[model samples]
Target: NAGVTQTPKFRVLKTGQSMTLLCAQDMNHEYMYWYRQDPGMGLRLIHYSVGEGTTAKGEVPDGYNVSRLKKQNFLLGLESAAPSQTSVYFCASSYYLLDTQLRKLFFGSGTQLSVL
Candidate 1:
C-alpha cells in the first residue's frame, strides 16, 4: 500500500488557466522528480528535489514549477497553462543505493493534461 499516488488522473485546461498536480509517497524517499512525457522526447525532467524544502530545475523547467515542502510529497504547478504544456506528467522518487551507486525510481501512473 506504500507507493506514489497522483490525484486527478486527467485534466483539461483552457489557455491561461492554472492548476497544481500533487504527488505523494509513503516510501520515505530522499529524492523526488517531476517529468513530462511527450510523443518522442521520452521523459524530460522538469524539476526535482533532493530533500524536503529543497528544489532544483531539471532538463525542461520553463513552463512548470515544483516544490517539495515535505519529505513524502512533491507538487508540480502550472502558473498559466499553455497548449505547449499539454502532456503526461509523472512523479518519481528514489533513494540512493550504495551497492549499485545509482538511484532507482518508482513512478506514479501519471496525470494527463490537455490545453485547448
Candidate 2:
C-alpha cells in the first residue's frame, strides 16, 4: 500500500505561474500536512488538515492554500507562484496515538518546485 504519494516530482515555473501539488495516502490517517524545505533550513509546515473537509494554515501559509476533499487526498495550491516560493515540498500524514500521546508522520517523496 502507498503510505503517501506526491505528484509532479519536479516542476519549473515562471515568476507568476501557478500550480497545485497533490498528495495521496492509503494509510487512512487522521491528520495531513504540507511542508517546504529550503536550502539551509529544516522542513517548515505550510498547511495541514485534521480530517477530511477541515483545513488550517500552518507556519508558512502565505501565498499558499490547501484542501482535504477526500480522506486519502490532500492538495496544496500556489495561486501566483514566486521565486521565493521555490522549494522542495513534502506532504505528510499521521494519526495521534492516545496511549502513546505521540504521532509519527509518514512523508511523501516530495515535489521540487522552481519559480523563476
Candidate 3:
C-alpha cells in the first residue's frame, strides 16, 4: 500500500507562475501537513489539517495554501510563485492512537520546486 505519495516529484516555474502540489495517503490518517525545507534550515511547517474539511495555517503559510477536501487527499497551492519560494516541499500524515503516546509521521518522498 502506498502510505503517502506526492506528485510532480520535481518542478520548475517562472517567478510569477503558479502550481499545485498533490499529496495522497492510503492510510486513514486524521492529521495531514505540508512542510518546506530550505538549504540551511530544517523543515518548516507551511500548513496543516486535523481532519477532513478542516485546515489551519502553520509557521510559514505566507506564500502557500492548503485544502483537505477529501479524507485521503490534501492539496497545496502556490498562488504567485516567487524565486524565494524555491525549496523542497514535503507532505506528511499521522494518526494519534489512543494507546500510543507518541505519533509517528509518514512522509512522502518530496517535491523539489524551483522558481526562477
lDDT of 3: 0.95
lDDT tens digits by residue: candidate 3, 6-111: 9989999998899999999999999999999997899999999999999999999998989999999999999999999999999999999888756889999999
TM-score of 3: 0.96
**1 or 2, greater by lDDT:** 2
16-37 in candidate 1: lDDT tens per residue? 9999999999999999999999
Name model 3 segments beyond 4 Å from true.
99-101
Candidate 3, after superposition: displacement of residue 66 in Å? Answer: 0.7
Off by over 4 Å in 2: none
Looking at model 2, how many pairs of residues clash?
Answer: 0
Number of the top candidate by TM-score? 2
